[model samples]
Target: MENYFIESNAYNPWYNLAVEKYLADYVQKEEVILYLWQNQNTVVIGQNQNALRECRVQLLEAEGGYLARRSTGGGAVYQDLGNLCFTFVASEERYDVEEQLKIVMKACQKYGICSHFSGRNDLLTDDNRKFSGSAFSMTSRGKVQHGTLMINVDVNKLQRYLTPTQEKLKAKGIASVSSRVCNLQELNTGLTVDGMRAALRAAFEEQYGRCTELSLDMLNNDKIQEYYKMYSSWDWRYGRSPECETVYSHRFTWGEVEVNLKLHNLIISECKVYSDTLEVQFPNMLEGLLLNQRYDIQNIQIPEFHKADEELAKQLKETIMWFSGVWR
Candidate 1:
């Protein structure tokens, strides 16, 4: 099969993801594609994950980080400039995850970093610290195997942004997220992103015959722009989240506030507010306003109440925002 080596210069997570999907959906020829790219601060969640549960929405908002959902199923991951991402797109007839992983392993081996596949879809160093995690998905014409390579990632930011479940933390036998991850730069200080890209290109050529370089313009056309709009929209990013119910209660200096929300497809299907405060209009004002609206506070429209109930409205907004994990 012919090998096409494509390098993306886009740093936006939505653009990069659109490019990946375009390759997987549009490229139907019998060829092996090796795509290399990177993104800014972004939290990419699996297709089957609950975004609010997988990430700290407040922290991500404050840090100017983006949240995206990929087509593949895997745990949420943090990406930044320090990380390198790769996508292997190939026809189903030539699709083999182990073979794709071998190409990645060969690239890492060139830098004297001995790594091996461990668990289901991870690459770990000799000390068992995970440096890479991959996920797979299939289209009608092709298959995609994509993963992130941690080079010099910020462990503190990763820990603060990603909120893995307690069961997952327990499975790793680690209490903190930082302890389970490692960076290739720590293993070899001389390694750089450019050097890694070069090594990977050489590995691709060695494994499959000579490669032809493809430009981003060839892939970033009108079709990709439509995908970018969908991927970057709030509705597609958050509205497609799985249905869930959450009850939150908090005690303030004034009184106690409790909110129960039943969400379907990330929209507030049912909402009930209970407060011990003497104010009654606050809860009544929010009664029907939140129905059929997104769970996001930014999309919520606040109704005008009596001037006497201004403080109550402010407190009510704060309570809902806090419990819903919404931040400015």
Candidate 2:
């Protein structure tokens, strides 16, 4: 039988350290799972992505937050006390990614909530709202699955922290700030963060077998420490991206304007905005927008321009609508 432990404490370095150890040291025959709680605000990005395009660095730093990169492939996610995190550690030979996902889906069903797998790797409700996001990674010996379940998170703050996907901003016909999302507590008032954690624990243990709770101090083996050091390094966190150029621009009545986004993989190389008009705020405004996205322009959505004259504004709005489907 496999051993599984569920934890209730909020964000700590030890939580991920345990996961790395399970993947590396735990023999293939034994399976280990962890449910981690994080109270501090943080952004966890995917392994195979550019960090600059994933998080709003200024907002995160102003709040004195931690930005972590995970061993998964997806976008960055905002996690806080209201979120419940889960990790499954198993030998690569025994890991069945699809079967593991079904275990999560079953847990949500037990709460009287119906969830369906959406897109490449997300669990959503019938109304097309996503509550849980997951990603996976593989080492030479084993595989690791980690993700988050939203309980009572702050949607306003979440939207404010992550860069908006261009397609979503354009197709919704509303400001990115106005996008809709929900929390588990909102749907089931009787359900708390701890309650959700218990449900997952029960469901996962049923199939993978069960084990007693093991404390971090007990599992501080040498191999585990090595994986933790790797996870916490700068090269593994923000130093894993390749070269790329991003574009950000604001368009108005006078034709259109464009900006060149420069980045050295994961860091901001520089920024340059060009326009034929005499607008003086182009550089500053572009810089402000740049603070939100690290080094990409393809996904950043420039806010609608402001006009002084009512008649001119109306005409510009109509013209903007025409290009909405085009540019967006």
Taking all chains together, each candidate's TM-score versus the true structure is: 0.89, 0.67
**lDDT tens per residue, model 1, 1-328:** 6789998898889999999988889766678899999988999987776777777765786778898888887778899989999999999887789988888899999999999998668999999999999999989888999999999888888888886433211111112223388999999999988889999899888888899998767874898999999888887777767777766667888788667777777787988888877777667666566677776755675667689878878876776567556422
**Residue 277 displacement in candidate 1 (angstroms):** 1.1
Clash counts for the predictions, in order: 0, 3
Residue 49, model 1, lDDT: 68
lDDT, each prediction: 0.81, 0.62
Task: Report the lDDT of model 2 for residue 129.
Answer: 80
How close to the true structure is residue 40 of candidate 1, measured as C-alpha lDDT?
88
Best by TM-score: 1
* lDDT against true structure, model 2: 0.62
Error of 1 at 29 (Å): 3.2
Query: Which TM-score value belongs to model 2?
Result: 0.67
